[model samples]
Target: MKVKGVRLYGKDDIRLEEFELPEIKDDEILVKVMSDSICMSTWKMVKQGANHKRVPADVADHPVIIGHEFAGDIVKVGKKWQDQFKPGQKFAQQPAIPGQAESPGYSYTQCGGAATYCIFPNDIIEAGCLWTYEGDSYFESSVAEPMCCVICGYKTNYHTKDRYEHVMGTKKGGSIAILGGCGPMGLGAVSYALATDNKPAKVVVTDVDDAKLARANEVISVEEAKEKGVELIYINTADMKDPAEELKALSVDGKGFDDVFVYVPIKSVAELGNQILGYDGCMNLFAGPTDPNFSAEINLYDCHYNSTRILGSTGGSIDDMKEAINRAAKKEIKPSVMITHVGGINSIVDTTMNLPDIPGGKKLTYLQFDMPMTAIADLRNLADEDPFFNELADICDRHNGLWSAEAEQALFAHYGVK
Candidate 1:
């Protein structure tokens, strides 16, 4: 079978090309991809290429498809898994296989989300990483992986009343602060924080940009959170003289934040998260940095005498993805708020390669068509040029300028799905 996909050759080498795929074995399954959200980690891997841990050393000779967070429909089911899975079922998958070198996206040539059709290996199916989605839209399932990462912070965080034992998960009804919480993952944290059953009494989100903070508040309004029995606040620490103190003042009794989640992989942000730690506070360094030697000066005094502690978490387990799917399906959470741009598979190369330069939340790519990368905010600007953008803009406006299942359905209709 001939399929189109973006492939990586070496350091900073990637291309969109049509390649021949051999017939799937009896144990393999075939899927037609619908949606994929580009990640900063994907760009990092593009820069490192063969040098990347998950990528093969001989990628120059044998290229691998590039994309991980993806969702699509099953096209063919092999005899080995006919009883377990069948064709035409909506599905999404977790890319990370514990202690395994070759998982989809980074290491597979025929089983990555960037392609129109990819094979699902027997191993991936058996690992329970592949999940049949029952959500309203494919984009939401594609976004589940990143949302899982954001939700993991809350689930992985721990607080302790005693020095002897640790209390797992975020402190219930306690004050929580998301430091640098205006980016994609940051906004996701805000949503999950408010939506979860174990809601925090006070949720404070801090960012450096006025526009970003405004957008965060607009997507997740303070009024909406109040209805959920939580006080949601947004702060722009761009010019604040004492940002840490100002942030701490927002907490109950001016004590400090019980849980501080650092979303930016920056030294100052990590330090600020440390400074705002309340008594018995837990700081979760959630962002992954490109630099291996990334370090921040923490408050040792608080760590020892004040019973404060710090930890880091990355990549949500399968359970986290399941929680994200259920929440999105139930309308309890809107992970789509993290998406700011959309495109087709043809745009995957430049979009993924230049992700850092791109200013947006999630850059979602639908694999079924060919379209230039367009931002949701820029849709109105292009309304006069193309009626497609005009219609898309109208659809988004109906949903508060956010992506929805309706918007996705419109895209499928507009692009004439493969």
Candidate 2:
């Protein structure tokens, strides 16, 4: 079989190529990718070029396959795998395969999911580590892996078995704010908050970009709060000289929001969210510093005196992915809303190289491999074949509507999507 995918061979360079499939070993199953989402991590890889940690040094000399967020079908089972596994099942899998040689404290593994076909060990199958969702499309199902990473991040920060368990105020009317709210992770926090059963008194989202803030409001349906008699404010954190003061101003009544979710890498939001936290307020850091060397200055005196708690989370865990999948299945949460662009695998390079120019923060873009033109006419057509796609397309359409179709086309064109 020929597998199609995006590969990086040098700095700031990615190519979509097809390759012959390798012989599958016993106890391994081969999956044909249904769809894959371009991610910030992949963006970082292309931006950094050859310096990315995840890009194997060996593959750096060759075209290394690069993608991790995706879902697919079990098309081929090895001789040993066939006895235990069946084909034609939907599965969302992790790409963190252990390398052949153990390096220092880390186990060596060659793993990735960007290719059209890849193999998974029987352990992953028997353990149910590969998620099986009956209702999710392959494209939408791929998001479960990303959701698992979010769950992992949630677990890292809070001690709760489930982060959704903590309802700030009422089941549907709690108070929350997301700082640097115009990014993907920020967008994820927003989705989680809205999808949670706990209601908020208000959900105030802020961003430096008026355009992005506008879109955030639409995607989350924050405006619907007005009809429901709930308070939701979409503000611009653009003018505030400092993140701390800016957030402090947002939290009226001398107490900050019941919950503050920081999406961008603004170090000050962490401190400020703590400073203005309500009596039992919880400020969560859904975003971290971009540079590993960066650290935020903390005033220990105030941090200890106030009952404020500051927490941070990253990538979802298996449990979190299950929860996210279930939530998505019920339409309680839709991850597709984050998708902003759609293109073929050939467009991956340009897309990652110029991500900022692309509109819609936390947008999910597709690299439709070998798909025909009739199926790829527009966002609406692109999403129609998939379940979660319509919701995601609706979110994109809402923002695309704010601008002229020509303008949206130009933006997509800049990323070589057209």
Candidate 3:
């Protein structure tokens, strides 16, 4: 089978092309991708090139397919899988299928999200990371996989530095302060925080953009919270020289929030998260800055004196994806708002190559895998119909076409994305 996808040849070089997919073995299940979200990690690879230690060295050498966050439907299952799995069911899948590696932990690399179809092993199928659901839309299922990554945060015990554990709990009372709340991952974190039993008492969101802050508030419902709900607040960071100081002042009666989640990559945000810690506060470092050389000054004294605890989380655990599936089904949260751009699979080359200029939020580049050749060029129209597309266009126009590769570099040089 031929699958259309976006591949990265090197830094600042991406190509959308087709590749031959291996025939499915009796133990493999092939999934037709419905929707795939552009992840920051993918964006990092696009800008920095694949020279990192975590990724498989050969993956970067080959025409590597780009994408890690996605949702899809089971189009065909092997004869062995048919007995346990059904066709036409919606599922949120983690794409990494481990090959010859010394250990599973280091060996298993998730699937590339930006493809028409993906194949998963039979053993992983039964583990339930690839969730099967009834009466769900493909677009919504796409959100589940990303949400699962957010779920891993709730299940994480950062203080112990122990393996992640997803234990269910009540959704009442605890407050969640989401730093860098305007970005897509922060927004997704907000969704997971809202849908869970440990729903924060007050959901405070902080961002540099008033527009994004306003956008976050607009998506939250006041009426829906008639029975039991969390209070939502969006704060802009542009005004504050010290976000930590501002956070301290905003705390209830000058007491800081219960949980402060740092989604921004800057070192200052991580340092400030510690300063504003309330008694037994949980500070979660959600975003992983691409530059490993980046480091920040921290006041360890605050951590010891204040009894503040900090934890770091990344990507989705299988259990987190399962929870994301249930939450997506409930419509309690929708990440669609985070999608600021939509282009076809072919456009992905230009789309990813221009990540820095995109300015905070998700960009969904469309791919016409199933459509005929005629559909490839015309597919932008379908994307234009989405509200987020309008937002992308407006942003692009506002920034003087900075969303393009050449333009973004100039824009980033001004803002120092390099």
Candidate 4:
């Protein structure tokens, strides 16, 4: 079968082309990609291209599809796993295949969700990274991979005084701060921290843009945070005289925050997150920087006397993905909260290239190839120009500008595709 997808050849060299997919072997599976959420990591891979470690050296010769956060349906299964998986079943994946440096979407030449179809290699299948999904929408399932990474970051920052055993996760009933919390990944961390059983007394989310902060509040409302017994505060520190000092004052005793999550990989942001940690506070660098020698200053005196520690994580384990899936199923964590834009496969290239400039939570792409990347909020304005968008705007308005499974169904119906 021939499929259309955007492939990366080298740095700044991504092309959309149609190619023939080879037949699946006895140990492989063919999936029809339903939804793929563009991730910042994917954007970084696009920018780095051959220079990226996970990118295959021969990518310039044989281009590779670039995406990872995706959900789909099993169109065909290999003979070896015919009994385990069947056609028409919904599926998602962890994407961080255990031993492989480059998982599907980053390294695999024939596998990625930017296309109508992709193949699951035997290694991925055997590692059990692929999951059978049961969610409200493919968008939710696709974004579970990123949610898993968020969960992993929290889990990684676990520490203990005794050193014999350690508590894994943020301190309960403690003050927490999320730097650059308006972005999609930061928003996930904010929602997770607020909603989870590991309750924080207060969560102060900081960003430069007031619009993004307002969107964050809209997506994860104050009422929702109050219901969870969390005091959620959104702050724009762009013009603050001393943002770190102001953030520290939000804590109960004004000592500092218990857990600080740095969502942007910039040195200044990371240092600011470190500066606001209280005694025994743990700071998790949640974002991956493109620079190999990304360095930041640390207060060693605080680390020694206050027991402050810093950590960083790239992706999550398969188990973490399962946990995210379970939480999404139970409504403990809403993956849909991260989706702000929707479109089809044709939107992948432009969306991926200009992801940083695109002001939205997550850009979700369907394999249908007809729809352009359209923000749910923008549909209202589009309604004035086109009757098709008018119906979409109505659907989005009903959901308060948030993308839902119903809206997606309406879109597919509008496009006359499934």
Candidate 5:
């Protein structure tokens, strides 16, 4: 079958091309990708190309697909899985596989989320990476992968009560802080923090940018969190007299936070998280660093005496993805808040390449359509030019100017309901 997608040939060398796929083997499946949310990891991969560990050294000769956080419909199921799988069912995939650095959207040329169609190899099926999604919104399914990472970050964190007795997960009903929060993943972090079973008593989110903090709060409002018995706080440290001292003051009993998460890969943010830890505080470094030698200062004194510690993670596991998909389906966490821009397959290269400069959260793409990357916030401005935008703006307005299932349906409707 013929497929069209953006392939990475070298550093910053990506092209939209048409290629043919051989017939699927037994035990394999073919799917039609509908929605793919561009990730910062993709931007870093494009910049590093062959130098990336997951990318092949011969990437210039054999190109790979460009997206991993995506969702779609199954078009064909092999005979080996005919009874277990079928066409027209929605699906999501977890990219991490045991002992395989090369994963979907990083190493596989024919198995990627950036195309209208791609094959799900037998190995991926056997590994239990492919999940049948029962959700109505494909964008929500595409977003579940990142939300899974958010869930993993929370589950990876640990706290303790006594010597040699380590407790897993964040401290329940304790004070929490997210340093340099309010970015894309930071927003996801907040959503999970509020929605998790063991919700925090106090949640403080800090960012240098007031705009980001404002938007984050607007999407997941303080009042909304208050209804759940959590005192949500948003602070712009740029406006503080002494950021660290002032931030720590917001913790329980004006002591320190029980848990802290560093969302920005900056030395200051990491140090700030270190300074805000109360006794037995667990700081989770959620952001991935591009630099190989990136380092941050930590208080070893606090680690020795107060049990303050640090941990880092790259992505979520299969179980995390299942929980993420379930949470999104149950409306416990709105991954839609992470999305700010929408585009099509033709827009993936430019959008992924220039993502850091773009002022938004997740940039979602539709593979079957050809449209420029447009901000969800800017749809009302385009209402005069296209009736489609007018309908989208109205639909979004009804949902508080955020992306919704109705908005996704409206977009597909304007583009012939792809």
Candidate 6:
């Protein structure tokens, strides 16, 4: 079958092209990609290209597809797995396959969600990372992998009292803080921390932009947090002379936050997060820095006496992905809160190149490459010029300017999908 996708040739060289998809092997499965959410990691891969550690060595000779976080429908199943999986079933995958040096989106030449169709390798299929999803929208499932990473972060976080057995996942009924909490990944951490069963008594989210902070509050409201028995606070550090001190003051007894998530991969923010860790507090460096030798200072005295520890995690396991999928199905964590922009596959190159500059949450791309990347808030402006956009604006209004299953259906309907 002929398919269209964005292929990465080299650093700063990504192109949208049409090509023939070779026949899938007997052990492979064919999938029709429905929705793919642009991740910051994907942007990093775009910048690194051939030099990326996970990218295949032969990518320069044969270009590789560029997206990882995606959801789709099964078009064909291999004979061996015909009973296990069938055509017309919706699914999502945990792209980080264990024991495989190359991941699906970064290393696979013929497999990625950027294309209309892709083949699931035998390794991925056999590993059981491919998940059948029954969520309301494929967009929600597309972003589930990142949410899984967030869940994995919490699960992996632990406090070593005498040995490495004391597991404290965000310290239930304790105060927590998410530094740089306005970005999409930060917002995912916020929602997961607030909504999960192991709830925090207080959550202080900090960011420089008041607009982004306001959007965060709108999406995950203070009232919602209150309903979950959490005191949610959004703070703009730009307005403060001593942001670290201000954050520490919000903690109970003024000791410090029980859990501090350093979402920004900068030295200053990391130092600030270190400064505000309570006794036995765990600080998670959630963002991956571009620089290989990126270093941050930590108070060793506090680490020894205060018992504060620091950790970092990149992605999640297949188990974490299943947990995210189940949670999304139960409406426990709304992954769609991370989505702010919607586009088609054609916009992949432009969106990936300028992701950092684009001021919104996740940028979702549909396999049907027709619409340009459009912000939900901008739909109102577009409504005046076109009736199709007017209807989209209404849908946006209905969903509080956020993407939803209904909004996705409305969009496909507007595009005349049968």
What does the lDDT read for residue 408 in candidate 1?
95
Residue 88 displacement (Å), model 5: 0.8
- Rank order by lDDT, top first? 1, 5, 6, 4, 3, 2
The C-alpha stretches of model 5 lying farther than 4 A from their native spots are none
Q: What is the lDDT of residue 204 in candidate 4?
A: 92
Using Cα atoms with residue i matched to residue i, what is each candidate's TM-score against the true structure? 0.98, 0.75, 0.77, 0.95, 0.98, 0.97
For model 4, how does the per-residue alpha-carbon lDDT over 1-418 read when each residue is reduced to its tens digit? Answer: 9998878899988887899899999999999888889988888888888888889988999899888888889999999999899998999898888887868888988898788899999999899988687776777888888899988887787757575367888888999899998888888988788766788899999999988988888888878898989999999989789988988998867999888999988899999999999988999998888777999999999999988899888788898888888887787887777888888888888999999999878898888656778887887666666688887778777776777778878877777766
TM-score of 3: 0.77
Model 6 whole-model lDDT (C-alpha atoms): 0.86
The runs of at least 3 residues in candidate 3 whose Cα sits more than 4 Å from the true structure, single-residue gaps closed, are: 47-50, 53-55, 59-62, 96-111, 122-128, 157-172, 221-228, 240-245, 369-418
Residue range 43-80, candidate 5, lDDT tens digits: 99999989889999998988998899889999999999
Q: Can you list the residue pairs that collide in candidate 5?
A: none
lDDT, residue 108, model 5: 91
- Compare candidates 4 and 6 on TM-score and give the better one: 6
lDDT of 1 at 50: 81
Question: Per-residue alpha-carbon lDDT of model 1 for 1-418, expressed as tens digits?
Answer: 9999999999989899999988889999999999999999899999998888999888999999889999999989889889988888999898877668787899987889899999989889888888697877999998989999888879888876557687788888999999888899988999998887678999999988999988988899999999988999998888789998988999976989899999999999999999999999999999998899999998898889988889999988888988998899998888988999999888999998889999989999999898889999788776676778888888999998899999999889887774
What is the Cα-based lDDT of residue 335 in candidate 4?
A: 76
Candidate 3, 153: how far from true, in Å?
A: 1.7
Cα-based lDDT at residue 346, candidate 5: 94
Query: Which has the greatest lDDT?
Result: 1
lDDT of every model, 2 decimals: 0.89, 0.57, 0.60, 0.85, 0.88, 0.86
Tens-digit lDDT track for model 3 on 1-418? 8887766666666676777778888977887765565666666766655463334556545555667566566778888778767787766665433332211111122245677776776666755556677634454555555566677776663322233333333224755678887777777777666667666667777888887786666555433332346666678877888777677666654677667788888887777777777755667777787666867766577667655667777666665566666666676666554555544455555556666666656665434332211111132354444443344445445533323323223323333422
